[model samples]
Target chain A: MVVATNSFPGSNGTTFSPNDILDLEKGDPLVFGAYWKKMSEVCTVVIKGWELMSYLSDAKNVCWFMLSEFGDAVRRLHHLVGNAVIQERYIVVGTGATQLSQAAIYALSSHSEAPQPINVVAAAPYYSEYPSEINVLRSKLYQWAGDAALYKKNEPYIEVVTSPNNPDGVIRQPVVKSEADGKLVYDLAYYWPHYTPITHQADHDIMIFTFSKCTGHAGSRIGWAIVKDIEVAKKMTWYVHMSSIGVSKESQTRAAKIIGVICDGYQNIGSIESELFFEYSKRILRERWEKLRKVIEQTKVLTAAKYPTFYCNFTNESSESYPGFLWLKCDESIEDCTSYLMEKLKIRARAGQRFGVGPKYARLSTIGTEDEFNELLERLSNAD
Target chain B: MVVATNSFPGSNGTTFSPNDILDLEKGDPLVFGAYWKKMSEVCTVVIKGWELMSYLSDAKNVCWFMLSEFGDAVRRLHHLVGNAVIQERYIVVGTGATQLSQAAIYALSSHSEAPQPINVVAAAPYYSEYPSEINVLRSKLYQWAGDAALYKKNEPYIEVVTSPNNPDGVIRQPVVKSEADGKLVYDLAYYWPHYTPITHQADHDIMIFTFSKCTGHAGSRIGWAIVKDIEVAKKMTWYVHMSSIGVSKESQTRAAKIIGVICDGYQNIGSIESELFFEYSKRILRERWEKLRKVIEQTKVLTAAKYPTFYCNFTNESSESYPGFLWLKCDESIEDCTSYLMEKLKIRARAGQRFGVGPKYARLSTIGTEDEFNELLERLSNAD
Candidate 1:
């Protein structure tokens, strides 16, 4: 069971330290679930790229049905970050990772010669939307087949491995352990430096990534996948094409500019004090985790999973916990953590049952504004 | 069989008219298929909408998981254009009309408790993509059941009606005569006043519209649907959410602003000599049709369809031929119109077979730049 927390603190009679005024103001309440304050900061730094305006008028970019400069930018960023392998991989862009997730499912199962619908499994405590997203199509290609851990089938199946899992933030592997015609689709949406340590370069058959989690450009709705199989890539691209003709050219162009700015910052790391996007993002995430931990430790109402230090190749340092979401497990005495948090502390959270868990766990977003996080800490501190 | 034509005339004996001064400089050859040149002209008119900037910062617009301002704008435009009835209808926004097309198919088919897969049919010589897009999913809920005109089945079915048909410019109705259990999805993509006359308000159960053909903002990738059934609307919205997480906020916001500019221009009509967007767009399309017809008449190599003039209520005038695509039929001597155009005239076009018709017909886009259309005319004129 896990509980994720993202709250803003009340100013009066709070044991928690006050958040920075600049940070508080930067956290525009208008953008829920987006890290725009931090993004705006980075955007301001690279505000003078006149070349970006060319994307606005370039008709070549508009007809980019197969691949765009945005896809190139994504590949370059992945190479620079050393998160995923790009060489010999066919990249398929989508509206978001959510779209790509379904695209992958379709590509993997649609062409299968199997007579019956193939089963799709993800480990329990999975991203809540996976089951619904997969089953909603009612496609004969595949069907949602409950939790991977409980699956006893030896038939053809596809296992989703969401590393740095959505609700719990734990590194995960496929639990079904099927060797007979089974496939693995790695959803590395939260495997960025800000969320987790870049322990190793991911070299999976199929992997998905999103700009939303990476750059907090959730509004752009741009995501991509790196597939080793050319056929799978083509099928995925076809799905994207038929789904929306192609991802938005305006969004893709803007994404390309934003990604280019990020890559440039990383390339010229030594000259700037902020180092790069990841450096600043990691710092902010680490600080929030530390402050939240202090408040939760005092409350004893909920406990977060303790993660071990890992050697990050990009930073060349031992990094602690810095996950996108906080998975908090409620005390046994609390029957429904999601409801308890909402009623007692006025903090809304996703209940664990949604992720195929019991009522004692809930997930809260830790990647919101500074004010929201501070409020969550204050609420937790005073709840007891 | 239908052949859509979008061609431009060439210059003098030098194989280059005065277009080298503009076309060569504007990078015309690079974007042969896109509507960028024409789109850029329209974009310039609404370039100063300062409200668009707020969309960049306002996350409220980003987290709008439900209906958005873009949907509202789309409804307003539909009402102003007298295309689709918006009152009491739920508007669901999508990446483009393409996404909404699939969404409608899914919504109409997935919820049925019928024992067998629902047969999906469209009239022959339909939008060629209907079969491929529907069958690609290989969903058990629905399957491509072939031409609606020839369908003799008594079972449940969904019929697609693409008015101002893609390859052909003729307005269409459902060919399937089963009113008992038959469902119709109206693809009114080219039903705008610019492309066709506003004969009467379209009040279908499910209707799809696109910004690509309307405002030529193909790059924006925004489209919408007016669904009469609330349940169908909710299911369509669910499909969108699971598909791309509610479309790109940036794209939607931009679409809203662009659509707003269009509607505002119409509200203040007669004040400006340019009039509204449809007025300018219709003028260009009408002029192109006239020029292309004159060239085709002189060649006697191919024949364009002659559409009847209709009194448009919106513009309060009798409107002539103004279609998004020109459906051309090659002379009896030419077996394959698409190849004949390419081999003899060096002009590219989509074959009629793609639209489930005989090879004698071909489609060309009339929505390109002034130079492209002129170049096409030159190529046709020289071919004879």
Candidate 2:
């Protein structure tokens, strides 16, 4: 049997083979599938046909579609991890961070029918998907105004700040400090201790998080936001309701179970029966980062992104960042780094140009299956 | 036990009470919960945390998030029911029909950059949420042009045709005609044999359906669109991809199991053990509509929308329309019937003005829990 009681290695029977074409372009987070697959033996969910059949969950709240159990579980997890502030904040759930960010833009811009659409900006080397996601429908409420650092408009703007940023592991802060009123949306998808050290609990006007990055349940398509203002939350809820009616209650119920189990595991820490989720995920990500760095050192063909050490309050230890993605720049001789890797090494990766960077840079995912990661290391080692 | 081997009556443990301020404003669809709760004994779903961990399901398909099992089950159920043509169609999955209708508009308007946004038209007394949904984001791609019957323009437009339409249960066809080209999106949420008589196989350019209307699994938030043109399907897929990343695999998996079970039961028809889904659901809805009509007859204060009986190809019988909502127009004495009902009768319903109709009409949901439906009937019976 491929299954093991405690820990298993190099025997994930479900994922694709290392011999198959490695798609490191997207941060799929399937690397943690082995951990979750093992955890399922101890934690399981059985939903009957009649369970969670209604469209409404809690009618009293602004986000009426959100189940109380799921809401409680979200608060419990945030309280347990000390990642984000839960007190006096409204929780709005979305299909994913992709949708929630759009919801944030809608919420921020929906109220005022300004003469011109509000400019939405993210700093250069921002998440590559921001532009496509914002401009998806040609929304007249907000338009993608590229590069927050360069945005000099004295008009109201919404800036999305992705911490422990995508493509690169650098922790970020909002850069567009204009005289005009600006609303900030923090994309804290990577604010968990597994990928980076929890320096502080995030407290912002609107902060977004995803279950995919936290629990490796990407297929669930569940993401949530913590909003300080009720009106903003309501606007976001209305946007979501008009767009998709509401979030999936099946995903919400299942999410409640998953997050509840996660909190329970940590609360029972130090017991032999307890199995830690972050500990397993962090170890895997840490090892992969080490291997990639060593391969880059040996090959001398690429420059890996560097990060400063941080004291993680949760772990009470200092550690370097292990981003969900590996941002690499070609060593001066190469151009269009994404094309070179895809053509020469057969490893698919996203070009940095998509993130408002030069063609010499590319971003590769660190959270794919183990075989794919191993194959990436092998290819990188032989690059020279 | 609230569990019956063959049949049970009036002992539902779930849902709200008749005495608890009935909310019939939205189509909640909890009446089918009684049937599903019983059917769950025969069909159960157990999903593990690790299974379906990857974001990608089938990378080859336009809708990569759609599981092959779900696609197959959808095709099989449609084939068995003979309500829709599944061949030469590309099935694109969304959060629900709410999202897919938006996707259809986007798909039709995305490639073209007109000086002015295209007018999206739906006939009067359409789904109450149509205008709000189309103008949700004040999208630059399309704008809501109310009353398709009145639209007289040579410019390109997108007309939504909802058959067995919401608010009013009359069968619908495209109302707008023009010299310029126009795209059609069919909202076939009520094209099932249980809700209305499926007169013929619906073969449209783009047809959207929902699991909530079909199987009373509203919480699953799963909807699919069958498109004749591959390019339009691709465009719709792109819109969904940027919006929600993709539909929930958890919902899709459960939908596959639920629909698969329904198909299996039908294939085993004539056996003593076999129990039909549509027959069970149709019977419950038929009884509710009959009871509601009786109550309306007792109280001449309101007039209900009329419909013509049709021969159902799937059920092989003639039946009157059992709409998911009750569209009622108050007598000449009453103005703003929704306000009168909410304030005087203590019943909540959506006003007709929301559906591009007059203040005298209001739409109440007929698919709420039995307790709520019964209370509505009792209250109406008491109305003078």
Candidate 3:
């Protein structure tokens, strides 16, 4: 117990120091710090050095590397909130959704004996990392074949559908109208009730989720793939095994504890428990969106993206979508929105070119620290 | 603190149950559980939900995902033990040594402009998984070329040198003779004082170490590369980011705590901090190897691998190598030792065929639970 004293950091929430740069280029999810800090007492986890020592979690399961606790937590979370369907699906855990996505790419294309790598395509303005992420391997099995919306051929391919997508937060389905049936890897990262309306339970063949976006625990580096096919699940597990051996058990244990707390908080709504994770995050994100929209209206030099209203099955209420990242179009006078903001306003935003679009559009993360968001608004209002 | 009660699983250490089957095929490292259990009080880690909120650890470091605490611990341990060159080296963390190895392959082969995948070679009787591990990527930049010792060409290639090698615990170095310069990825997984003598501070260009093998924390899923070249470190970092974004912060935090405990125990040798890690583990491994050799003598049907004696710089004492695995050769009458052990004696051992050797030899993991090892010895001595 004395040895644990040094490690048991006081549950006063994340100790954050303000940075000079109000950079919102990446959705780093430091904004989730405040919420977790509020519930810090209930969110802290204690692990022993000798606990969970084995590399294999459950040998009987198809995904032998995934912890039984984590698998249960994921299934329970999805079941609690009407998100992805979990029954009869194999839960294969990975380091993160990035690894799972790559695994999906590998698993889908591995069946083909063709010499050429299978084409991997996503819609225009996809997650900026997709192209380079896939190309990083330079695998002979697959290659990034550009935007699916522009792909003219009907040849077999791997289609990535980022519903309640990354850049724009617009609800989307597959746009690839290929006659040949291609495999689908659903990037349902933002499909949580906090971000968008869960119109229907995601019944996709392969759906990936991350603890970072779902519970604001990006540092945990835990994610899972709800794979329908047993062989694909096994292959994905093989990919993870070949890559990282498996996800960290410490991370999985922490994830399991956090998810349990979130679920318990919801179930014990009238009790001594604190705010539900989804409700707390949704309120913060909604407020951030409103403030950004007001700043955009005042500036009249930038255009904030608009979202369609939809009824959520989880909340059972009509609301506009609140995306984690803000996609803004530049005014006609500005040639490059990202550079203009960086140079003139001292705000850092990811340029549109990285997302397979022109420089006229740029992205700023709404899920930054409160101070950073406020600074962003101040800088936007002062824009010339 | 009320929330902490549930997550604070008591550090009584590694609740292990003896299994029906004695599986000695894999080097899972559950043997370290008992040592940790002995130091359970000082071995537990407590983490708050809001702590380590961001995805990045240190933005300035080449390995942005690596915690500064972990980096410091690594440097201190290597410095204390005199096993590696710590100065001017860049540390890149991965999920495990498996991922780091893949990253090393990518880093070494990234600049090759050749249309064909670069050859990856290891000597015969090499690590069993090397061939398939490299081939799994099927990357255009690299391919498994097999047997570095027998490559009869002058072509550029990537060579892997696993010192204190996996199946056989023998210290090794680059064996290839080529006119054109080739790159080396030194897998120093078993180079610790427990397995072999620290002949000299390993000054290999790209050296990798794993927490699983070093500290016996495989479930933590943390491994690092001590890369001499800045470019290679950066490229490995890029590969990690593209694959898994980064290693888990919780895993790093726990590793930092455990490594700190180990170092502190050694420094405060006269105090009541319990046994030093290396001292404890080395004693256990030596006893296991001795017991195994005695059992082999009792059987008279198998010959145990004989290692040369040397003085360890860390221990400052004369000792013969105590391998984590038992490499044994069956009698010439037996065609396949693996099948003979499994079918007749009910002992599971990895056949030499997987290691690119004939089936006369087999490997049994010495790094398993005490009961498993006892059972292995019992099964071996009972061999007819």
Query: Comparing candidate 1 with candidate 3, which one achieves the higher DockQ?
Result: 3
Better of 1 and 2 by DockQ: 2
Instruction: Tell me the tens digit of each residue's lDDT in model 3 across A35-135.
Output: 78777777788988787677878877888878899999999899999798999999999888999999899889877887788889999899999999999
Residue B137's C-alpha lDDT in candidate 1? 72
For candidate 3, the docking band is medium
Alpha carbon lDDT at B59, candidate 3: 78
lDDT of 2 at B340: 81
Q: After superposition, how far is residue B196 of candidate 3 from its true place, in Å?
A: 1.2
Among these predictions, the greatest DockQ belongs to 2
Candidate that beats the other on lDDT, 1 or 3, i.e. the better one: 3
TM for candidate 1 is 0.85
Q: Against the true structure, what is each candidate's TM-score?
A: 0.85, 0.95, 0.95
Weakest 10 consecutive residues, lDDT, candidate 1 chain A? A46-55
Query: Residue B379 of candidate 3: its Cα lDDT?
Result: 82
What docking grade does candidate 1 earn?
acceptable
